[model samples]
Target chain A: MMRIEDILMTLRMFQDENCDVRTVTLGINLMDCADSDLATTCRKLQEKIRRLAGDLVQEGTLVAEEYGIPIVNFRLAITPVAWWAADYGVDGLVRVARALDQVAQEVGVDFVGGFSARVEKGATRADNALIAAIPEALASTERVCGSVNVASTRAGINMDALLAVSRSILDLARRTADTDGFGCAKLVVFANMPDDNPFMAGAVHGGGEPECVINVGVSGPGVVKRAVERLRAGSPDLNLGDLAEEIKCTAYRVTRIGELIGTALAQRLRVPFGIVDLSLAPTPRIGDSVGEILQMMGIGRVGAAGSTAALALLTDAVKKGGAFASSSVGGLSGAFIPVSEDAVLAEAAARGDLPVDKLEAMTSICSVGLDMVCIPGDTSAETLAGVMADECAIGVMNHKTTACRLIPVPGKGPGERAVFGGLFGEAPVQPVRSGGEDFIRFGGRIPAPIHGLRN
Target chain B: MSDNSQDFIIAVMAKDRPGIIAAITQTVFELGGNVTELSQTVMGGYFTLILRATLPAERKESVIKQHLEEDWPDLALAACVRRYSPERLFEPELDTAAYFLTIQGEDRPGLIALITRYLAERQINIEDLYTRTEGDAITLILQIHPQNRQSAEHLRADLQNFGERQGIAIHLLHRDILRATSEVGAIRRMVRQGGCLS
Candidate 1:
């Protein structure tokens, strides 16, 4: 029998700390839904999605209630439209995006991803069309998300494709200027992207995945933050090693719940359970931010001297614990430091303590690169590509998945706020300096790094 | 070590003291018995123990009771012994079927009777229970098992309403969750078992 203290402590982690399965994303491969005619393709896509994911939300709710944990969102990741519906140009892709949005609403999902293009080495005709359609597709649809993979360790950075994608990203921001460039929040640019990520705006059913699967994303930044706070309150001499162990134990428990819920949900849906991603995805709520976890680690102000090391500790401990908790762990299983989504991180940016430069430095050590960052609208396309290029270089060299969701809030400058309501929260526009315009305009591939050819 | 062995149930209660369990087991050992399953607790000023032991088939339940009373007369604790059989099931499948029903509120009376009656009417069994009071606060924790496939949601809703009426907080959760968070091996064991039913 479990002790009464242990039972109440676990309940406290839920009722107080923001521990939840952030998303239970059902990945459905839509390669078979291809058709030459646009309407046929749209109908086939919608029908297939409805057939597979119609019961996802209801079953997810049942599982959440049974487990006594919050499964906050139900999302879908379909095979990239660029691969299947790419022969259809920008207009056709936008229409496909609309159909995806409608079906997402009908099936009661929060988001549907994989309106994406992968032009790592070079762009095919399909990749180009999807890249062109990204701005309008995201702007026109509510729940549809897009991602463009412009670099990889094996194939190096595709500068040409990245330049085109940056322009589209800028266009996307302008198209939703009414919401302070919110449309760009639904798109991501990645280098060496994971095929099985269950979070948006980068989630997709990659080519390597099964036909249909259930991937669960669990988050508990607040849980870890509280654990650290408890340790600090108990002993003043508590060392980093002790802190790491505390985080590892907390993360292990959270991952166990994620895997349990994932297994139960997969059984209920009758699909193979894909993986449990134990990333500490924070929300706008207080105590739920990875930034606050750093604060609990003795960093008084975020973006101070040791923020990167703190983040590295957090991200590594999370992965170590999650690895033992689930045998089928994949996706981006590290701490997310999204500025706008995390309240403390956003406030730090707003106060100029966490600058774009410090954020980029943290990107090298955190889960994903430069997530949910708002930049000045006057920042040039070349500068946008430059930022992507720098982050991609880090990922290519380190063999980690790095992505950027940089929204240039139109007509907003540094120290001004851009609000994207709900989970895509608000952040002050960060200043972007112009140092790499000449290099970005050169527009040629940076060949794969030497270590990338280890195999 | 002998094949011809019989199991005996032992119960003892006394004023709370140190070494109560050690003395009872010592008495059982001298009687040529081996302790198998035992539970002991000290609440308020009273100590209580219930144990099951195996002894040679020759030793009867009355003989074991007489030995315990004779050996530890000064202890002044009640002792009872009985022959054990496997004909009756005393507990539900505890490993999987256990849940915790917790009630917490200002100090009051009749909380257990009120909640237990509700559970009894629904055919749900309360296998074990514990209560603690500190100042004006009181807490009752009951380990319950629902034999049939009952909708936990409905039970929760009903409990919430009852809690509201009584000005207390009542909650129910699976025991596996507590075990999973507290024990490192619990989760891996669950994955190996596979196909977990709610």
Candidate 2:
């Protein structure tokens, strides 16, 4: 005879799948917060962020408790600051970043990103200044995060910007080598950057977002992974469809928890509710990799046969479950393959089995593109330009968000390993196969592909 | 020609062209061999193929290798004759796990080897990986499973410290790949004109 508790437990097994909350990102719009005077700009930026985000941490905690979910991190994503700092130059930009940091501390957010610019096709003087200031800005400010968009599906990749950004990342690291380029931790060079992403360093209030909206990022890679393991243990005969069904069910529960937390947080914060991003955002830990999930599906390696199909299934299942959970589900709601953020992915990178090209291929199906990859220090800027071009083409052609967060480790090459501590794992600094400086000298915007002009 | 217990495994790499499959399959058929398993892929203009076949008792691995190499010099062929593992013939248990890992750093060679060697030593298995390059910057992913029952978070922190010294960002976490099917039961009851599962 089964006790009532046992029966209920069996029926409620899915509830455990929904235990994680993806992100509690506080959105701060910086467009109206800047001033001509550097001091005024900094003060305004600080006041605005502090005023808006002051209650964010407490509210997020209350909501997490109410929904019985773990809100992993409290973060802030502001409007891209490059545009506002166009007239102020690097010095002025640094001051704004300092103010941003102060506000982040006051609000108790883990990270405050959005010192960014959208330049998928080309860049202006302002964009250049911001990109140039990356190393210093990140080193100078503890919380200010920066991301520069050098590629987009419609406009292709800006080779010039990519080359420059690559150099900027390297310079930033070298300047702060002692800090493990922790400043680089605050930077993400993107293509097809999302507007509603609630994950920091990359999260920014998209152009399409509401002025003040509360969004959520839900994570449950552990829940789905456990279900797969259980299914395989219980029944060897289960097919791929059976596996997919389990994934969807797990995702549904996880999505519901995220919605519950987000809704509760918004109500308490007295802000308009926004989308819930159901991204399998992983931390620097084992057993939490999206790539490991694909491996579990029987593919010998990450880039091998049936990889895309598996990713598509996972992405779709997550979206389906999340959509059903909330009417306002939006943002990059899919499995994330950020390399530096997942330990399993980092290990595969250290092995020869995974390559940068394979990572690019997987991005076609995953939510984001080739991210947190390392290359040889001597790699010519042109090679970086080419990679950016290829990734941007994928995003524009497929009409999806793609990004590149490449690190040019000083004094390293293919086959040599570098270990970046804490959340950023170890990586094999893959050497570039190409090294043509001539291509980068072309220096003109690649015309937006005809497809982008389409509706 | 009456060998019932002999089998041959063929591994071939060649430039992809027309009739490659037909040529191989036809060769086996004409030679009175039964093709049991086959897998092929075309990448970077080269075609890679693997085949498992049962051959007549009189045939040997050397004979097949000799004949194939002599007949088709254009096709780089390698053959090994051995007893087949029955487990390889059937799908293994469908157990699956998913995870994410992050590694950041100054560029170096053999970083993958260093990390994977650790996993291999600990009985952890790697599945898939994704990496991107912008100039010298690199970020990569490795999906893996641990054979031991250690805490995933503990492993991640250790790797993180390792990465910090080398300038690599390391983050590892497991992915939940499936959910329980309680809701499916509700659907079954609602559609009870002989439910879909039944």
Candidate 3:
């Protein structure tokens, strides 16, 4: 006869292993539904997303209950509609965006990523038109998220695309400044963008993926933190290698549960299951932070001397363990160091311990680049362009994916902080490097470098 | 960036010095080879250099390798040169998983031996490693690519028992590295469709 405490302990142990379903992303492939005719495309998109994702919220909740894990959010990733939306002009863009909003509301998904364009080397007529319409589309749509990939490792930096995106991101921020740069929040500019990332305003269905695939994102920052704490409790003799192994073991269990849940969800949804994205994606909550994990790693704080090595270890262990657990573990599967969403990181930024330069350094060893980074409202578009250029350069040169979603909060200057509540947490407005008059001025097209054509 | 191309991996090992890069670079330059990609790190008094140098159609790997050895013989060097076969570039079925497998214990002598033995049995490949001792504890972060079908849980379980016997705590996290995000895919598609995939 087991005591109630023992039962609770077992339950807690399981929860500690992989407690939460990080994300249940319903990928709605809209390519088939898209029409060259603006109104028809909008109508089909609206109808298709609403119908496909309509059961998302309820199904997600039920699945979480069944698995004894909490499903934190139900989201959607649609095909990038910018190319298709160009036919009807800005108004057509507006209509399609509004329709997406309705679909999101009806389906009860929190966010829908991939209202985007890819202009790394250059833009298409459709992509150009979509770029022009981004500000309006983002402003009007309540749930639609937009992303533009303007740089690659081999391609160097696409100055023409970066300059245009800089202005557009500024325009979006300015238009929606009152709403916590809400429009800006909807936009992300990326390098080496992934195709089946389940996280949004960055998620999109890659052409290589199945028609419909359920991708799972697993989150267990607190669990990993707890393991670190326990290891450090009675014994002080443990070294970094031992600590890293503990993290790897913890991540392995977490990833196993995620694979089980994702596979189950895909089976039930009748969709082909995609990879279980093992990204240590965080939220604003205190315990659920990648920074806290770094702190647990005895770095005192993130962005310190041992931060990169620690992250590299943590991230690599996560991949090894996750790869063994699931056959199709794809997407951004490393430990994500998103400063804004992780409370500890945000606090570090707020307190000035973690600077932009440090964050840039951290991204080299970790997955993703400067994400949800907040800059002063008065930050020059040129400086933002430079930041984008630097980050994209890392992506293109390294042959990895990196992105930036800079929110120059209007009237919010440096050292000021804003709390956007929920997942889009508060962030101290980091100051941009001054004096980009030269690089910004020399903004003619930076020709594609000779190395980008690796495929 | 033409499709009619080849890849060669040139690994340079030598004593830590400043001009080693310059000398190697000059050799590539004189040989009409372009240094396309390179990463170098100095550790424990040795400089390790890895480069993916692109050679024009006329110059082959043998010529490039010969130039380095014949010209810079005095620079105590061991070179491992291999041409990049086409298959290595795009084997989609290749396991793309990258993770940091960490092992910690009470500074036991056989901790690494035990962990690596298990990993070896499962055919897991370690990409990078950083290990050190803090007081009496030993920690290692092994960036690994586990073979297909072997679960991280199996390693975690094996390590757990190993740690118990060795009086240490072991942890594992699935660090999924190199898995392209959805955004990268969209960019590739959009670029291809836009006639910019090249």
Question: Which one wins on lDDT?
Answer: 1
Residue-wise lDDT of candidate 3 within A284-384, one digit each (tens)?
87677889888988879676688878888888888886776567788888887777788999888888888888888778767788888888887777888
lDDT of 3 by residue, B110-184 (tens): 778777787778667766766768798776767766554244435544666766776765544433211111011
Please name the candidate that would achieve the greatest DockQ relative to the true structure. 1
Compared with the true structure, all predictions reach lDDT values of: 0.88, 0.70, 0.73
lDDT of 2: 0.70
lDDT of 1 by residue, A1-455 (tens): 56878777787788789888999999999999999899999999999999999999999997777667788999999998899996788899999999999999999998999999888999989999999998899999999999999999999999999999999999999999999999998999999999999999999999889999999999999899999998899888888999999999889999988887887788788898999999999999888999999999989899999999999999999999999787878999998988999989999998889998899899998889999999988778899999989989889989999999999999999889999878878899999888879999998798998888988
Model 2 lDDT per residue over A1-455, tens place: 11223222322333444346757887767788767788888888788877788889987775454223467788888888887878778777777777888888888987888889888777888888888878788888877788888777678777778778877887886776664444665688777788888876788876866667787887867667777887889998999889888888777766655655665577677776677788887767666677777777676576666777888888888888777655767777888887767777767777766688778888888887777777776666677767766777788777788776777666777887667776667667776678556777687666666887877
TM for every model, in the order presented, reads: 0.94, 0.67, 0.67
Stretches of model 3 off by over 4 angstroms after superposition: A1-10, A13-18, A444-455, B1-198
Model 1: residues >4 Å from true position, as ranges? B1-7, B16-19, B26-34, B54-63, B85-96, B186-198
How would you encode candidate 2's per-residue C-alpha lDDT over B63-131 as one tens digit per residue? Answer: 766666656666655444554555542221233233445455555688778877866665566665555
RMSD of each: 2.5, 22.6, 19.8
Docking class of 1: acceptable
In candidate 2, stretches whose alpha carbon ends up further than 4 angstroms from where it belongs are A1-18, A179-182, B1-198
Q: Candidates' DockQ values?
A: 0.47, 0.01, 0.01
